[model samples]
Every structure is written in structure tokens, then in C-alpha cells.
Target: MATFLHRLGRGAFRRRRLTLLLWAVVLGIAGAAAAGSGSGSGDSNVTLPGIEAQKAYDVLDEKFPAANADGASARVVVRAPDGKKLADSGPRAEVRSLLADLKDSSPRVAAVADPFVARTISADGTTGYAQVTYKAKATDLTDADHNRLDDALDDARGHGLTVEASGSALAPAAEAASSEAIGFLLAALILVVTFGSFIAAGLPLLTAVVGVGLTMGAITALTAALDLNSSTSALATMLGIAVGIDYALFIVSRYRSERAAGHEASEAAARANGTAGSAVVFAGLTVVIALVGLAVVNLPILTAMGLAGAGAVVVAVLVAITLVPALLGFAPERVLGRASRKKSGQESRPKTTASKLPAAERWAAFVLRRPWQVLLFSVLGLGVIALPATKLELGLPDDSSKPTSTTERKAYDMLAESFGPGFNGPLMLVVSGGDPAATKTAVAQLDRGVKDLTDVAAVTPATYNPAGDTAMVTVVPKSSPSSEQTKDLVHSIRDRAQGVETATGAQALVSGTTAMNIDVAAKFSAAIVPYLALVVGLAFLVLILVFRSILVPLKAALGFLLSVLASLGVVVAVFQWGWFQDLFGLQTTGPVMSLMPILMVGIVFGLAMDYQVFLVTRIREAYVHGADSRTAITEGFRHSGKVVMAAALIMTGVFGGFIGGADAMIKSLGLGLAAAVIFDAFVVRMTIVPAVLALLGQRAWSLPGWIDRRLPHVDIEGEKLGAIPAPSEPGHRDADFTPTH
Candidate 1:
């Protein structure tokens, strides 16, 4: 691997233009492809086991009528340049025009909100919106449904309306993705600023582009077999941008530094492969492992994210090591603007360290001087800033209370205000068995308990299936879906439901928005053990292999655990405690998104591992050269501190950028992820890691020499870096050059 990579790097230096053109073509195609995906129609792949999804679906079928009613979604708000927004009147003209046109066009338009009539337009003249009240028969609410709605909105926007839509799955997604694309590019610019070179800047984004393209393509393919959610699109984009850019940056910086130290391009690429490349491989894998942790929850959305993101990270790391080196080999002599380093050196030059490797002088000086004090203040600061997180509620208003300011939100608000919170009602428990009589008894048993539930407005007629042991029972809450009363009503049903496992063969599970969440939370709570255990176990093994020490893995795992717990604690205090609710602009009763903490840990763990890889790669390299663990730890922090911090800040900006978007889910996602990266990068990686390592000393890399010798050896170190293979490799180095200056 090293020999091949080394040869490839050397050739890259000789043929810069060809390499540039190849990547340009690749990017042009990717961009064109992405633009073509404007509506995100092609991305979907559900990884949840079929049985699980079947169970959820069966529950859906047993509950609400097997009809086509989509619970109401958020409404759209369109404003003109002067704040003159049209609602009922706006959608009226368009709807009527659309209807009149559909007379000549298609039937789908007439069925949608009756484009010419009531559901298509608001009563007011300032806003244009359509209300699609899914009659109790909406069996499918996929992205395509959302896309159709967006197309309708787009038709309106095309005629010179400034549009803001907040409803349907695609509505949030369109807002999320369009904004995210801009953010990824903004982050790319920030990355360029940090690297201070176009090629340097472009390389990470290039890797990111490749990663996203392939991930998007693969995800698009997955939709055929899996039930991948629309949210997965935004997820892939976010992860692709964040990991792709960071992963490439780590390697490129190392490669350029190696080239300058009098090593041939092949040798430099090899060394980069040996050090930064290896770290990247582990970091990327760790991300994959962390993502797989989401599988524990058994939710389709998370399961899909885990699989897709796992694939994305893999692509990112491979490209960082492969394509990046290929580009660097043919890059101009002065890659970092050193006119002479470009033209100098051969394979036999002295082994130079990765440039980001911390030097002993300044690092030891700083750590020894203020080690404990820095630790004290930073940890304290993290604790204080996290104090406000106590008010974070996990629940959002059900589909009934649209979380935006549009007509849908108003409709939801009106419903809640008029109908009490449980207008949606209790969860439907589906049973597929032989006991027609027993199913009847089980449902009756369930309805009686539900009637006994506190704060119930009423239980609707228990429509039962004698043949399938199926029953659809509705239990309306005494309060709105947004109220604590309704949540308690849901809790009562799950705890004391219509189906008793020990007594009856019938299975009764909750399927309403409220009930589904309670089940999701309970299920998520149960998975906590194995999720952490697997993450720790696998990450430990990877860390051990990479650093060649048991102690380092333990320390890495421990520090990461602390950071996650601290973050979770903040989540609990803010959302659970209901403190500072107004300050943060959150609901007092909303709990953290059930899937968020686990996802955060996985994502943050991966990111933490990334910084760990960057910081420790060269430090490990220093150690193999005989530096003591303390020196290595201190030096490692200094060496990669700047780069890791820069990446973290940029990612922080990228994740936080979405807060300005339309959906609260996106805002929460942005803020939560941003917080995790910022804390891990600046606090844990920079200060806490070194302190803990200094305290632990040599234990970090302790492996018996005999076992180490016997273990299967993987090479991270490369031999030649500046040249391509001798006519054997498929790709030739490009002649186009990027000024390293």
C-alpha cells in the first residue's frame, strides 16, 4: 500500500494539470448531479429490520382508519418585498389558475387542496397557503408527497412570490438542505481561509464532494429497498461536509509538511500515509463504529443515518489518502509556497515529522506552567455554560401544533385551543393472531384501563377485528398534545395498556405521535447499555491498534465518556429541569429529542476520535522514535492543536449555521452538534486529554512486545511519496500545478 501510494504521490508532482482537470471534471459532474437532485427525490434507504418496520406499520394500520388522512402539517407563509403577504387570496389565484390549467394539464392538481376552492387558499389576502387535511386514509407520507406539495409552492414562488413554507417533510428538508449547501460552501471558504491556499482549501472540499456524491448516489439507490427518511438527505449532507473536509485537511497538511522536509513527493505521501493517513483511517472507522451504535435504538431514521453516514465516512477517509496523495504528487514544487522544497529531495532523506507534531520546547513550556489552572478554568466554564441547558424539553407540539409561524401553525394552535390537546388520541395497538374473541376481550381490557387514565377527554368507539385480533382504539387527552396532561395520558396507556403479555396472546403497542415518542424514549433508554458498551469496546480496540497501547485507548475512551456525560447532563438539566425556558426559547415540557443524545455521542465521539487521531498520530510517531509518553502527549496536543481546533471551529460554524434555518429540529441539531464539537475540540482534546495522559504516563501505549509482534501488522507508514507507480497504476499524474504559495 505504501509503495503504491508513494509512487502515486511522486507522479502527482510531475503531472499537476492532468490531476486538476480530472478533479474539475469529477466535481463538475457531481455539482451537476446534485443540482439535478434539486427536489431530493432520489435519496432513501431504511436499514431497520423488516420485522420492526412491519410491526410499526401493522400498528399504524390497526389504529387510525386504513384511510388516506395525513395529520395536518405546518403551513406555508409567503411575503412580498414590502411585507405584503398573501394567504387565502394568494393561493386562491394560483389554485384557481392551477385548476383552470389542470383542466388542460393533470388531475393531481385538482385533488390537491381543491386548488380552485377552500383548502387551497387562506381567508386572508396577505398569505398564500394550502391546507391538505389528510382524511383518515393517509397510508403513505413519504418525501414524494412532500415534493408534490413543494412543487405546488414552487409554482406559486415562480410567479414572483417570496415564499417561506413550514409544513410537510419536504418543507423542512428544502429549508434544511438549501441552507446546508450554502453552509457547506461557507465552511469551505472558512477552510480555505484557515489553510490560506486554494489547492489546500479545495482538496478537503473536493474529498467532501466525492464523499457526498457517492453517499448520495448510494443512498439514492438504497431508497428502492429501504424506507430511508427525507431527513437522511440533510444528514448525509451535514456529515459529508463536516467529516470530508476535516479528514482531508488532516492528511493534506501532513503531506505538504513532509514534502518540504527534503523528502521526495512519494516518500512524503508515504510518511503522510504512515502517520496522518493511518490516523485518518482509524478516525473514520471510529466514526463508523459510533454511527453503528444508532442501530441499537431500532428506529428507522437512525438506522438509516448510521448506515449512510458510515458509508460516507469510509469514502471520505479513502479519498483523503488516495485521491489527495494523487493530487499532491503532481502539485507544483512550492505546494506551501516554498519555491525550493518543490524541486528538492529524494527517497533517502532523513525522516521528518508531520509538521503539526508538537515541538517539545513551547509545548512543555506551556503545559508545565499552567496545566492545572487551565484545566480548572476550562472545566468550570464548560459546567457554567451548560447550566442553561437544564431547561431543554424533549417534546415538540405534536403534528397538531406546527412549530412555525405559518397558517399550519395557526391551525394547529386553533385545534389545540379549541379541541384540548389529545385531538390526535391514544396509540393504536395491532394484534395479528387467531383469537377473535380474545382480541375483543383484550381491546376491551385496554379501553377500560385507558378510560381510567388521568386527564382523558374520552375514548372513541373500539373498532375491533375479530379475525386478526386487531383493534383501533382512540383515547383523546383532556388537554392538547402540547400539554403535560396529554403526555401523561400517553404514559398511562403504555404502562397499563389493552394488551397484557402474560395473560393474552394479543400484542398492543402505541402508534400515535405522542405514544410513539414515549415508546421511542423507552426503547432508547433500554439500548443505552449496549450502545455505550459497543462504542467503548470497538473504539478501544481501534485506539489500541492505532496507538499500539492499551492505556491510550482506555484514556481516550474515558475522556470521551466524561465529555458525553457532561453534555447529557446539560441536556437533562435544561430540558428536564425547565429552567431558563424563555431564555433559550424552548418549551418547558419538551424533553430532548429521544434520538438526539445517542446520535450526539456517536457523532461527537467520531469527531473527538478525529481530533484524537490528528493530535495523537504524530505524537505516536514521536513515541515510536523513543519520546516518552508525557513528552508525546504534550507535544501531540501542540502539534495538531491548531489544525484540530481550526477544523472544530469551522465545523462548529457549519453545524451552528443551521440554527438560522426554519425547523427547530434543525436548529437543535445544529446547536447540539456544534456544542459537542466545540467542547470536545477546545476543552477535552486540548486541555483535559493532556492532563489525563500526563497523570497516566506510560500506560497509554502499553502492549507486551511479544503480543505486539504476533499481532497482524497494518502499515500506516509509507516508503516513497513523490512519484507514481512505474506505468502500472491506472492513473497518471496531471501536469497542472497549484501554487503551494
Candidate 2:
């Protein structure tokens, strides 16, 4: 691995112009393809096939075409001004006119139902709602369509009525831009501090941005042929930029270290690519493996997300190994800090005594001195933070979870206040069977049974299709959509469905936005254990290959799990339990987003293992080169500690920037990922790992003889590079070299 990478890096450096041109060409091709293909829509359907909600949806799609299963819908909630009633002649005329105008608002407007005709007026006649249906899905709606809808809404508000629009078709309130800009700025600052040169600092940022553009362009281009989710682009951007910067940071930092150690520009670039680049590749592969493992859950949206994110990481790895070395070939001496440049091109020796060692080495020495206490306290602290995870409840976010400033949220509040929280989440009961009469009887029975059930707010009479082969009934729960009681009610109705079927000889299934979201949450929940097992198992194998040891991989995986759970606990505390909501700019809190746990596990696991591989690989490298375990720990920290800290801080800053987003899911994701990086990078990898390994001594690197014999060697530490004599050394050969190991 080291020998090949050395040659590759040297080739790229010597032919720097060619390498840079290749990357530019790739980016240009991707951008052109995306431009020609244009933008695409996302697939928000996450319902599992076997679930009741999905089954109900299938029935509706087959038997009742009028349900408009694929179309978008909206509710325009209108309230009369103070001292006014919607039923009054004057207000009623305005409301009727508003509904009439909605029909001609846009060509995409499929249908509009009046409040009076649909009997949607509030019992007090103070508030009413009109239903607007669009011919296309929400993602397919154009800016013109939105403008027309807005014009219609504005006209209604022009009267004395208080009008707000909610639902899927309202073109979800414009989201605040993601944390990319903030991430870039923070990464630039951190890189500048780490490298102490504006030019050098910009290399990582430059490579990262290029990698992101390439990945995003490819995603956009492919969207023309695929049903990729819109969120996939955002996620890919986040991971691509982050790993791109960090990967480049590793190689650049190592190159400078080599330059400071008296290696010439070309040799330093090759050596950096051979050693740090190997770690970057392994780190990147771990992330890719963890993300692509999302396919195990068998959901298309998640699969696309994982694949897209993994593709970004792969691009980052390629850019780091090639572009970075090529760029370094330009002016390697300029990358050196002023103090490093003053050393006049001589090899530097390591400081022997603790007092003379760098701060990282001194910290390692201090931890080794009291390994037991450090391990105990670090483990206990993480365990305490993980306690909140026990009470975690999962649900998808709704308008109620949006910021109060959004019209959707205001509309939701108005409807919930006037009608009841249940009005926000009506469950649709679909009854169908061989006999039309039997299906009608089943629908009637369901309505009566559901009404008698506790927590039932109201059950609408059954509406039958023209064939009378299918019937639909709407049941409203007393609780909000995300509430535990609503989920329980959904389950209760499904349980009672069997009796209704047995009596009337018809099939009854439950579905609606609320029930469908519940099913989605349940599906994600069930996938957690399997997804975790897959990521951890694959990561464990990858680590074994990288480190050639069992205990180290075990320790790395366990530490990652600890950090991930602790991060999730914090997410639940903040997003679900409503603790310190104001601190995160949250207007309200309920159940945490259903997929956040699995998402956190996949993403955080990859990043955690990344830190683990980078940190531990250095220790193993020192040990393999004949340093004692204790000395190796100190040496590894002395060489790699500062870079690791800088990488983690950049990753944290990038992720933390998302917490400021208006979207609840994005905010939760940002916070969860940021917190995980902090815990794993600072606490687990840095503190607990060192303490635990210090106690284990040489045994920490032990592997069974049989396993070692069968395992394929992966020289991730670039140990073979030792055979390649430095330019300053005697008997050095420029052309041909053989790897010793």
C-alpha cells in the first residue's frame, strides 16, 4: 500500500499540471451533465409494504382513483375578524368568492372544495377551512404555481378574514440556507490557525469545495434518471465538504511535518501521501462502509442517501491523495510555518524528556500516570449522559414542529385551537372486499366501534365509491399527531379491524398522513438494531484489517457506540423532552424525528471510527517501528494530536452550523452529529482510548497467531516507506525501490 501510494503521489506531484487538469475536466463534465438534466424531485414515500397504512394506501389507489393519492393537498384556514361571524351574509360572500377564485388560480389546481358545501365550518361559525387539491406532487409544483396560490391567499386576507395556509401543497415555508457557508468560514479559520499560513490553509478548503461541487453536480445530473430525495443533496454536501477538508488537512499537515524534518518537496509530498494518505483512505472507507450499510434496512430513500454520501467520501479520498500532493508540488516551502522555516533544512530529533515534549505528549504522559482514574471517570460521565436515551420517543416532524413564525405552524395552531388537535391528524379507514354490501357493512361497523373507543374525537360517516366496492371513513383522535396516544389509537383501530372483518367478511385497513408517519417511524425503529449491527460489524472487520489486532477494534467499536448513544441522548433531551428549547431556537418540541437515531448511528459511527483509525494507526505505526508501547503512545500523540483536534473542531463547526436552520430535522441532525464528534473526538478517542490502551500496554496490540496468518495485510501505517532512503541519506536511489514488508 505504502510503496504504491508513494509512487502514485510522486507521479502526481511531478505531473502536477496533468493531475489538476484531470480534476477540472471531471468537474466540468459533471456540471454540464447537471445543467442539461435540470433539477429533479424527491420521493417522500417511506411506508413499508406490509404495514397497515401502506396496505390501505394500496387499496385506495386500486379501487378509488378520486382519492388523488399522488397529488398535493392544502387547507386554507380562515377565521373571521373580531366581532364577526363566517356565517354572516357579508363574510359568507367573501369566503365563497375566495373558494371560487382558487379554482382558476393555476392550471395545476385540480379541485377546490368550499367550506360551507363540505360542512367544514367550525361549530361556532368563527373559523372555516377550504380544501385545495393540486394535480402534481408538492416537489413538482413550480414557482408560478406557488405565486398563484399566494395571490389567492392574499386576496382572501384582503377581506376582514384571518387566513393562513397549511398542508403539503402550500410549498413548505422557505427553508433557511444550510450551514455550508458557516461551515466553510469556520473551517477556513480553523485551518488558518492550524497551518498559520493563509495560502496553506486555503488548500483544504479549496479541495473540499471542488469535491462538493463534483458530488452535487453528479447527484443533480443523476436526478433526471432517478427518484432521489431532495434531502440527499443536502446530506451529501455536508459529508463531502467535511471529509474533503479533513482528508486534505491530514495530508497537508503530514507534508509540512515531513518538510520540517528536512525532506525535499517531492519526497515530502510522496511520504505524506504514503503515510497520512493511507490513513485517509482507510478512514474514508470506514465512513463509506458505514453509510452504504444503510441499504440493509431496504428503504430506497435511505439507500440513496447512503450511496450519495458514500460517493462524496470516495471523491474526498481521491482528491486528498491526488490533488493535495499535486497542489503541494507548487510551493511546498511556503506551507511551512515561519518558525519551522528558520531551521535551515536539517533533520530534527525527537525530544526525550516529558518536560521537553510537546503539550500532546505531556498530556499523554499525564494520562498514563493515572490511567485507571481517567478511564473510570470518562466512562461514568458518558454513561450518565446516555441515560436520557431510555426515554426517547420517535416520530416524524409536522407543521406543529415548525417555527411559530411559519404560516403552516400558525394555520396548524388555529385549526387545533378551534376544531381540536385531532383535526390535524385524521385517520382514514378504508374498507374493501369481494362483496360491496359486506364492505359497506364493515365500514359502518368500524365507524361505530371507533366512535365508542376511548380518545376518539369524531368518526365521519362512510363515503363509498361509484362501484360500492370500497368505502372510506375518517376518524379523528383527541391527541396531536405526534402524541403517544395517537399512535396507540392507530394500533387499537387495527386491532379491532379483525373483528369487523370477521363479522362483515370485508377487509379494513387504516391510513392517513398521521398513520403513515407512524408506520414510517415504526419501520425506522425496527431497522435500528439491524443497521447498528451491520455498521459495527463491518467497521470492526475494517479496523481489524487496518490495525491487525482484535482488542483495538473492539475498543474502537465500543467507544463509538458509547459516543453515539450519548449524542442521541442529548438530541432527545433537547428536541423531544423540550429541555433548553430556547437555546436551540426551537418554538416547540415533541417526539424527536423518527429516523434521527439510525441517521446518527450511521453518520456518527463513521466519523468516530475515522478519528479512531487516524489516532490509533499512528500509535500502531510507532509501535511497529520498534518504539515501546508507552513511548509509542507519547510519540503518536506528539505527531498526530494537533491535527486530530483541528479536524474534529472543523467537523463540529460544520455540523453545528446546521443547528441554526429553520428545519427541525436539519437542526436535530446538526446538533446530534456535532455532539457526537465532540464526545468521540475529545472524550472517547483522546481520553478513554489512551487511558485504556495505557493500562493494556503491549497486550493492546496483540492478535492471535492463526488470525494473523490468514488476514490479508493492509499496510495502513506506511511501514514499507522506511525502506525508501531519503534524498539526504547515503546510497539513495531515485528510480527503483522495493518494499521491505
Best by TM-score: 2
Root-mean-square deviation of each candidate, in angstroms? 7.9, 3.0
TM-score of each: 0.75, 0.96
**Candidate 1 accuracy as lDDT:** 0.62
Score each candidate by Cα lDDT: 0.62, 0.87
- Backbone clash total, candidate 1: 83
lDDT of 2 by residue, 1-741 (tens): 777888889988878889999999999999999899855566665656677788898888889978736788888999998888998988898898888878888788888988888989888889999999988888788888888888888998898788999877776556566579999999999999888888689999999989999999999988758878777887898899889999999899989888877777789899999989999988998999899998877767778888999999999999999999998877676777666677646557544575777777788888999999999999999999999999988777788888788889899999999999989999999999787889878887788789888889999888888899898999989998877798899999998899998887899988998998888878888889988888889889989889998999999988998998899899989988888989888888888887677877899989998899889988998999999998889889988998899999999999988888766777899999999999999999989999989989999999999999999887888878878988668986453323111
Judged by lDDT, which candidate is best? 2
